[model samples]
Target: MVIKLTQPPKEPKELGVEEFPRLGIIGGSGLYDPGIFENAVEVQIHTPYGLPSDNVIIGRVSGRVVAFLPRHGRGHKYPPHKIPYRANIYALYTLGVRSIIAVSAVGSLRPDYAPGDFVVPDQFVDMTKSREYTFYDGPRTCHISIGLEPFTQEIRKVLVEVASRYNRTHDGGCYICIEGPRFSTKAESRIWREVFGCDIIGMTLVPEINLARELGMCYGLIALVTDYDVLVPHQPVTAEAVEKMMTEKIDIIKRVIAEAVPRIPAEIPKCGDVLKYACV
Candidate 1:
């Protein structure tokens, strides 16, 4: 069942400023619990958008304060299209999280980007049809520019360095985000691979990335390649196969996060000031 907070809990006044989590990790499919967090506390946050997918888990990783949120809730109850992307990002923002590392399982579009590999996507193409893609929906509209690069380079550099030490890691790639509770058709998958030159495909990146940018928070993705998206002449991608692959490779993913957390710089250069020029 989807978890929602009927009454928002007040932030504890006893907690010091240093205790606020600076790093946020949004866990994707099969990643309900971030097994690496220590001294974890579940904080139910209520955002202007609504309840986040689940309670934000505040914990320590590598002795640094970090927050973990499961994108699909504890039981994977929310579909990609139905995910509360706005609320999720907003909830993290309220917790003083300045940088976010989004961990997701994706289907590889190219043959070389094989299964059980890790990719740090520098770019993303949003093909999602229906979802909340932004935060400034009303009178106070802000035109957030994501022109140069969508993902945070500061975080990307750290993730690339840390992930390479563990497994087969692609330094950079293009992620195509589609609206889905369903996998791609063969024809559509081929076009994304051949025509669009997309390296990876997944469902829930759009609004999450956009909202983070709007909030001026540094955001980066560490995509775990789960299966070939039907373009390769192998078994057609299935939910079962994706889950199996994520299960096998979760250890490697966790290791990357554990190592990368401590290395991410506290002040990511231009990411925090993104809204300065964005608001008209």
Candidate 2:
């Protein structure tokens, strides 16, 4: 249908409490559209950090309302290092979003985690530099503990269950996030795989995950493996190849999201209380 792009309400209450969506999806790489949202409308939200990557698309998926944001903006204008992580998470929080499913195109760091596979990362290593990593950087001084579990187990379970029906889905993995507008060198790729034991490699997912936690939001990642990150001999990852693979497998990602959105538990008891012991 014709999805209308409109200005956001001054406050989320202006849209009525019931209209506020609890679920948010951050679309990465080639996954701009979920292709399952019905009656979608785009709303531009402004936050203290800055404007989000793009307008948040609010719609119904599997009869539940969801907010979708293109992580890199519409034309992929922002590189991984340049993404406004704090703004994006804050914008979603302002919309009453309490849970987020971030979709990303990642390279396989291991041979078994081949291209075209789906991985729900349970752990992550941040190797990124020069990005705002937290919300409580001032008088508040919140030390949000992400040591326990960074990605929400509730959401990851749902994503894994749904994705496994369509493809080779790995229930859990360790993702290594690197600062990049560029691909990893062979030496670096080897270190991540052989030395660090990273299952997947990507540019995003560092500050984004950390920021989501600071807001007391449940965050999960559905990583689509698009290439072997130079760890596998004779197969060096390239932008064109990654893009092409993502395009080919985008349908499966859409289906997994469409199915998983409604299955996520409506009330995650401890999720909202994340900030209780975090403030200094």
Candidate 3:
């Protein structure tokens, strides 16, 4: 296990940690946390790397405490490839956070996974480059059997089943993880439609998945569809328009997350410790 046995800084504020949450949520794009967590406090961490994306917010929602981090930073400063994937995960892990649930805004690649839909990705096809995806590196026993199924099946089932009972509009889809802050061109979106048959596409979720996989963390994604890719010709989509839509949907997403957050059982899954086998 790549455990950092040292104690963190004396004061979390010193490390710039704003909060220490039990559950971790990596919010993407314009979707800031709802401050739904009552009695929330900010905590800091001193990772081997520099600071995390933003200050960590820790508090309770529906009686379940969760840690919320703006994956792209609060102002969406970091691009898709530039996110400090390892530092974010390591910081969360350091905070005694055992599981992660990421919520991202994605473009629909399939006609069925349209705008205003919610998808719990069952599979990930990564095309991400220019990013570091794991902690296991160099000549050390830097290997773990990270299968393609990086997502926790049980957790995903929880999301899918809960969404099914809560909102009938939600659906499941395959997420195509690409490398970019740039939206895919018409031709690229078409390739997803014709060749790969992915239901949705997004800039992030690549290194995020792999890092979680190697770390033995139970991970799942709840992708909120903000727009159809260039494949759909309703209007010329830009970052500005996507931001507007995301801002509008913040409450809707929070409502969904708040409903789902309480359902996470107290029992921790085994995925987070799978590294023990390969590490030794």
Candidate 4:
């Protein structure tokens, strides 16, 4: 199959919209509802990568321009690996989203961070395989220069501040991105925590955050601690529990997003400026 690849229109933003969104959000599990947004409009965007996971919801939050997309689709149809990462990012990029806040539910890799905790990761380990990781893969080969720490520190600070501003109990932690529709086995969980020393584990995030960095977007994440992983002594980690906690954590996360949405900086400096000296 011959796929044509070229730079998308320069400064090409949707017509009739005179401004760029101050915030762009990719909602993972338990973040499908747009009811929190005032005067929200569902916008279907077709990108070169493919269809976005769902319609991009454009609305006002604390008077800031916010664009929201559910990475797993409206009903959470696609798994992490199956998600169309390219299109989701491209759609937001095309829309001129300068900063993105990704919200996801993760299993705690450490004892200190249990269910209900929120984390803003400073580093990421991409264990995600079998997913397209770039926007340029056709005739033109473009590389996204990145450092070890993928998430923007400036954005991270904003997220942490937002958590504090809302009186939301959140602590910064390291996030480990794993490939899965399945929870880790006990042995796998042990290796991830004990051996790898990752603070949290989740299926999505890897390519999603990486691509954000590639485009120089100020990207950050608000992680909802859903479970303690399968390593817990007798807790017997289960999908039902992840889902249950995810639903409950959604309220906390929704509050955090609502609080953070208004804080997105109107003037975007160089993308990845916070991580300027970090990536290798």
Runs in model 1 lying further than 4 Å from the true structure: 1-18
Off by over 4 Å in 3: 1-20, 146-148, 165-170
Clashes of each: 0, 0, 8, 1
Winner by TM-score between candidate 3 and candidate 2: 2
Off by over 4 Å in 2: 1-18
TM-score to native of every candidate shown = 0.94, 0.94, 0.87, 0.87
- Candidate 3: which pairs clash? 17-43, 17-44, 18-42, 18-43, 19-42, 19-43, 23-67, 216-272
Clashing pairs in model 2, backbone N/Cα/C closer than 3 A: none
What are the RMSDs of all candidates, in order?
2.6, 2.4, 4.4, 4.6
Model 3 per-residue lDDT tens digits across residues 2-21: 12223454443433345444
- Sort the predicted structures by TM-score, highest score first: 2, 1, 4, 3
| lDDT tens digits by residue: candidate 1, 1-280 | 2233444333533222246787899999999998997767777767888888988887789999898999999999899999999999988887778899999999999889999999999998889898888888777878988968898888999999999898899988999999988899988998998899899999988889999999889999999998998976657888999999999988888988999999898878699677887776
Residue 59 of candidate 1: its Cα lDDT?
75
Whole-model lDDT, model 1: 0.87
lDDT per residue for candidate 2 within 1-280, as digits (tens), equals: 2222234455544543347898999999997767788877777766788888987888889999889999999888899999999989988887878999999999998889999999999999999989999877787788888877888999998998899999999999999999998889988988988889889999999999998888889999999999998877788788998999989988888888889999987778677788899887
lDDT of all the models against the reference? 0.87, 0.86, 0.74, 0.76
Over 77-112, each residue of candidate 4 has an lDDT whose tens digit, in order, gives: 898889999888888887768789998888888887
Better candidate number, 1 or 3, judged by lDDT: 1
Candidate 4: residue 209 Cα off by (Å) = 0.6
